[model samples]
Target chain A: MNATSCYETLGVVRDATPEAITAAYQRCLGELRASLNGPNPPPPERLDALRAAYQTLGNPAARQAHDAALSPPTPAVSADEGERRPYPFAFTGEGGEYFRIWIVNLFLSLITFGIYSAWAKVRRETFFHRNLTLDNSAFSYHGNPIAILKGRAIAVVLLIALSAAQNAGPFAYGIAVLALLPVVPWLIVRAFRFRAHNTSYRGLRFSFHGTYRQALTAFVGYGLLAAISFGLLFPLFYRQQRTFVLDNLRYGSAQFHCTASNGQFYGIFLKPIGLALAGMFAIGFLTAAGGAPKLLLPLAFGVGTMALMLFLLPYIRVRTTNLVWNHVSLERMGFSSKLAVLPYFGLLAGNMVLLLLTLGLYWPWARVRLARYRASCMSLLSAEALDSFVAGESANAAAVGDEVSELMDIDIAL
Target chain B: MIAADYFDGRSSRRHPATLGLRDGTVVVEGDFGRRSTALGAVEICTGADQTLSTIRFADGAMCEIRDSAAWAAELAGAGIGADAVAHAERRWHWALAALAGAVLIIAASYAYALPWIAGLLAPAIPQAVTQSISDTVLKGLDGGLLAPSKTSPQRQQEIAAKVAALAGPGQLPPHRLLFRAGPTLGPNAFALPGGDVVVLDELLALATRDEEVVAVVAHELGHLRHHHGMRQLLQSAVVSFVVGVYLGDVSTVVAGLTALLLESRYSREFELEADAYAGRLLLATPASIEPLIDTLLRLEQAHAKRRAADRGGLFGATDLLSSHPDTAGRVNALRAMKR
Candidate 1:
């Protein structure tokens, strides 16, 4: 995927008027609806994405931001942003202060037997959002605790039903697994909506507008293909999934455009698998030549697994971040991540060692370090003020769907 | 007077403004021109950001000051303050005190509360549920790694009768004594939380004496008596809870994986308790703890032989070979209690 600006995504030209943009957005939605292969209409992310494009293009202020980002040499937009230097996201949460809040929240949750976890969830989300600054402004979370509790109630009931099904008999368990297969895509959509709807930047809430049919097609349809092909088509599935989800995302009314390609996904995946295979071949040859007849098989298996994990895990982390962020843009403001394989690999491996050595007390520091690195590594390739681009949304998605998602522990958001 | 930055909330333009109190009103003068509003007209959010304090007008125009104290000073007499920062930044003493309190609470819960809860909940589970669990597990195992026991049916029944006789007076009559060929789970015996005691064919063949096999059954019986499986599950849930509280994301896959990884793993204490229970149960049998001790040492040796044979080394690295408690220590402890 390349930088297909929101205007292009909604099928509008650079100078399209507000009325023209709205007409284009509606046209885009209708085309999407006609293209749906299911009984259901487009998912909220799809509509939200189109709506975001409409919102931004419709508003004079936001339009100018997009225009400025599109044509940076214009000089007028950058002047208002105060500083033209590269701005990195910043986090100022101290372990000590957060620890106090964390422990209190934990203690309350324990006493309440998980009832207080909703409140804890809100507190923690709010804390992280408040600390994370993109440019000078920060993000905010506006999830409702009572609504989350209700969602959790539903989730717990579902979990009980699932657990019961597992022990009910083999036939019932098999049916349960098959039933859950179709629900995974729907759950992902709900989770995306819940997350996008609750998160806000500059008084404008985030939104997702992908259709349910699209998700079903991507997850279930491609899921079957991947399974049949030993996951070789997984890159294509990931490509579709990310495109639908990320491209449909909106911060206020600005539709996000994801240009991440399947080829890039394959590139990231295959490199690690290739490296691991090469190491495996070397180890296999050495052991086979040594004449340690009895030891050969077990050592090959163990060392192969160890090498694959060592190479694959870090490779995926770095390359996937580069693939996603470097290809994705909100309108014309590009998102980029500078994560390297070695550093991240070292961080994860060392963190594991530290966690084991400290008997888990190092978790807080480890978490902070990871957060700081990720935050610092991510940067926006824009000089325009980020807040100026997204216009406020009018639609309201109830808190229930998001809460339900929370209960199910579904997460694809960043 | 506090001169701070402002945005119209509709445009990206910044307003350089000086803010002051005017009795019943708050006055602001900036490059966008002078404007005054009733003090109640604006919503004041202190600590909206760690460094920025926000004042939002009903009309969507907003101003933010960097110094929280400076913003608070202007609004001190108005009594319209949402001091979220002061609340978060309690004294160092309070922070330390809370830390100590939290640590104590976590420690106490893990040490006592979890075990108590598991104990309370374990008895309520019906035999039907446990039977279903055993059936599913055995059925799944049979389709793949496990085969029918090659041992003669007559030998199987003889051991089954011993297990049943030993389990006769127990709180839980062991749900079922099952056997499977041991290609995968070599020389292993385990009790699922549902009370089924499964002995592998390899372990059955390795034990030359019936007393040795009976001792293993008695040990498995101890696990059932204390509901070790259920307790292990509960303990893992509690560990996940602790992790969730700290990470602040209970819903993430990473968090769930962490919980799953921790859940089925037993602590050294659980293993020791099970061992002690087995020792007490076998005292009434013909060989006392001697056979149990002999079985433990032999199993350890058998496990070492398998690993050493496969890897061409590291018989000394027995710790890595097994998740079970140290067999030598267990044997010594069993010997010490042999009076």
Candidate 2:
């Protein structure tokens, strides 16, 4: 008998009724039972198989489900059908709803002397993850609070040790800082692994496959190069870091590919510097050429500097996010982002203003607002069905790296 | 029965299903298949605000119940209730209570707890560290806010000796007096962590008599004796650090400025404390507390004049964010102490 279906196992056709299936099951079981006492007795496992088949096909609900599973899948939408519009990511989180969670977390954390912070982190991440949807499927976070607490404890200890070393003397401080240099890359990699392994979409977990050696080269070696070159090589370093992170990321069986070039990163960072320099030159030309009053010179410089400062950060952030995400792909699925610089800057400025006005009470609302805006600007650049990807082998990553990096304020975009 | 999305965990496939609890078994029947597992065999993750409850089977299959209310009700009917944290998070009143509790706790800690902790901890810092901090702070101020003293060497020595006589000997951390020309700082005197009393030239010029200068230095010596500088540093460090922890996503500039404003209150208390110390010391000497009172009045006049001239840079941060106590309060406190 074919083992593929219950009907086949019972020597019955697909359209067999419940009575027919039960009869087939009874006959098969009797035959096996009667031969049990013979020298060439049929195995008892055959009887068990017959009973199992009978059990499933005997139930109407189970039979209907079985039939559905056996049916062929519907054809996927073809690309040539002109239905290739990207799927927009949506954030359904509300300010008032999140504020409750944030306040409660804060209160608990304080009362527990910060021990509850680990649980708070889990809840916050879960809140964000569950609210974020792509193509109607939400993501999920499954981080353990105990792991986070342990990591935070270790990070606090390290922080105290570092401070103590600083007070001990220059030599001790140097040794402490130098020791941390190697650990930085390790922590970065671990953080990536921990974050990715815990995030899930459609029951398939994301993962990071980057090794420590690669992280060190990207974060430390290139970081040193950027620093030694007085930040001239910073764009290259940034590209390397992003590539190292993006290229190693995996969603189920498909690996994410980042085709973002170093030159693109250079363009993202250099344009602002170029604009600031031009503004400076223009100001200088006006002042020297007697185009404006000398009394307004300091004001002009101050305004110019402030404008440049405001423009630079938002511009770089928007351009880099668009550059990196737009060039990223997971198998046939691609990513897109249209985060405009001015709107982002406006949002941030408004958030800061309201934050000040409310004396930090605007924190939860600000986060929700930012999350909504960010989600709006992002999309999946694919028309292909999302269910084709398979789950990969799951692994547990220690939260120490993630928590420590968080404590150190190292922002690694996922 | 609750409608849910089920995943076999072998692939990223969604199977629309209906889940039911029967005889301690969770049965998920859907288009794809039917899975019935003993309730005790599956893991149930509690739901929170707007998040679904997840039920995981031993074979890596899982189900997500999207209707939080219905799922919660079902779980309750089945004797599986929300966890303690989730229960607390479910209510608006609890959240508000937590907020009130947190605010009260933080305020109480800032007002009473931090001062007590800093006072106990400040004197316990190693002497070498305190000395290093003093040197670093003064060096950082030099050549920028402070220039070399323009006062004649003789006058500087005379005032230093008078202040030294006031402090007396056998002070655990012996005091050292230094003079600098603080044109930018303008009529200020401060004590450092390791018993360094710095008196600016502008401050000396503001005084009418030599005894007034000694009184000002004597006030700074009071700060040294109480380790107010070190205590202030410790308190502010803790404040900024806690603010940073609590507001991790906030801009560092904003957090630091907020910490600074909050810390000004503590500084005012320290100032008044140093003033009382100065008043007591002056009462023991022939100069009396009259000079210290006069110096405070003079400094207040100078500060007000500078305030008018500067037009309140950074939106009058100088007066609003001033670390020093108001002159009236300091003078009144000193007068009361003198009696």
Candidate 3:
């Protein structure tokens, strides 16, 4: 079938301004309307042809393609495209294979008593790189093996030191040993940078900039908060951790942006905690009131608290992390939002209480909450325009491919 | 020009143009006397001949007429299509709600049944009362149920020797027993219910020091006297009989017990009755009151440590357990002389 030509329907020259194209489209539509209801009405076929022509040319991508087709072809190919033609890396069981690789790596590390953590790390990196594709271009790893080994070696040493300190005595040297745990965070940052630098998509090498000290500082801050609040501050702690990780992570040449609104996010996070406290207070007051009536109050309070938290928790998370997208690229995307405290607390408390009461029946409940929470925090958009080239068509025709395709074989003469 | 008039309720104007004919068709002449046939219909033509004549239908239908003064109005309202709006899945939310409901059910069951069970079992078997009855039975066998004479200093030493001999070499010496006089304490003697027994001084005065005191001490020894103390330790350590009694019905017990344990305060009378049984048992032992009396005093001193440890393990706080009776009261009762 002959594809519709977007440029002809829009009545624009090859180098027409976007404004001029729009005006011409409006004029052509006006003329078509006049012809349809004039003293002599146009045939039904011509009316259908006009509608199809308008639809195709109205879309932007098809019009751009059609314009590109009308331009003269360049003799020389771009350096990037010439050196690395996009490759289609198709594997029948890609998802399953990646999952198996993760499982096997985990199992091997476990069997070897964590001696294989370094191997597992490399395997994970390879799996991730292999799966990532851009315009049929698969990423390849060119990371330094020695750097990875060095990072892993540092991590292992720290782990051993921590273990030795914990086992030395209940009190003696344990605190001193724990002080050295910050080294692990530094090693992780080094390892991430090493891995990212090795990943290549069409020769555009991926890199990340993160500091071990920063990660460690964030961890300590989170720990302190958790301790001070008697673990009630877990939601806030997690939010900080998430923000740190996301902000620190970089893909290819782009860096992610992370910003959180403390007040708005905390409002959501503290909701469940407030509800729980209120329920506890109510139960106490009712018990003090005395008689059979006092006995029923606690039960009602518990049930009501649970019900309210269950509904509000998800709502709070979605509202809190409905991230606003300020920037994105073909190779990278950044997200920023405030951490929600109340929803996290509600979800955590409600799930824990329910799980304890029901043995394990609430596993699915926990799973769904986690899934919804993840969905709330994540948003994806393709940075590059979705454009496909037609071999024989002009750029303008390609750009307005939809419009031209819709007008195929139609009689434009009235 | 096609003209029609109608009243519009929403508009402030008294009369408005009512477009569209009875058959939903409107045909009018355009500029330069050109005849235009608008498909649907037009009923009202109120403006000048140069006004853009158009047809608007009930179903959001608006078709522009070219340079026409009059045209049909086929009003068509734009209704939202089914595909345009997406329905949200509330299944996950509902599942979470159902789980929360289940948690509430279990918590409610625990809260309701536990206290009822505790109340039911508390009245059936009073540990203090049973121990007192056993003490009375042993005292009758010992020849004097009321009073036992105080032993000589030399005799006290000899009795200690005999208890030490019976205990054997490598073993620690038998706990001492003490005898004190107290008329209001009644005919009861008690093994301290821990590691020693105290014989009442009134009962000691009623009998000569040797055989009666020996038999009383022997009976008290039957309890603390051997692995019985160990048995009590094991029972108290391994089982939560109090909790079991309170939480026997799994459905309605847990929630109630948690609430009670977290909130309730026990009475002072409960401690005194337990002490009465210990006094009665000491009177039945074949040993002297010196060991029992010494142990009770030592217990009173060591009681703080035991309480601190228990509170640390159970509630992780000491202030919460402050309402319970202190050890000083029981020690004072044991030291009281005949009055």
lDDT winner: 2
lDDT agreement with native, every candidate: 0.71, 0.83, 0.44
TM-score of chain B of each: 0.71, 0.80, 0.26
TM-score, candidate 2, first chain = 0.79
Q: Report the C-alpha lDDT of model 1 over A252-279, residue by residue, as the tens digit.
A: 5566787887777998788766776786
- Runs in model 3 deviating more than 4 A are A1-117, A128-157, A181-188, A191-203, A221-240, A290-321, A324-379, A382-414, B1-339
TM-score of 1: 0.65
- lDDT by residue for model 2 over B71-97, one digit each (tens)? 878878989897777777778898889
| lDDT for residue A33 in candidate 1, whole number 0-100 | 78
Give per-residue CA lDDT, model 3, range A208-320, as digits (tens).
55576776766676768888999777667656655665565444223455665455457666876687778777767767866447458767867876576565655554564
**In candidate 2, which residue ranges exceed 4 Å CA deviation?**
A1-87, A160-179, A224-235, A261-308, A336-346, A381-384, B31-34, B37-41, B46-51, B135-191, B196-221, B242-260, B275-324, B334-339
Q: Which sequence of candidate numbers ranks them by DockQ, best first? A: 2, 1, 3
B130-220: candidate 3 lDDT, tens digit per residue: 3554455445535543344454667566655654544446543244565544343333345543335666654455444444444445445
Q: Is candidate 1 or candidate 2 better by lDDT?
A: 2
Residue-wise lDDT of candidate 1 within B1-339, one digit each (tens)? 787776664434466789888786988898888889998778766653354666778855677676768777668766655544346434556646555666787677767777788889877778776667667777777787678888888988998887666634655445578777857556778787777888888887788898888888778878788877676666776687667754443246767666555543455666677779888778777777888888888887888777766774442333332457577877777877776
Which of candidates 1 and 2 reaches a greater TM-score? 2
Better of 2 and 3 by lDDT: 2
Ranking by TM-score: 2, 1, 3
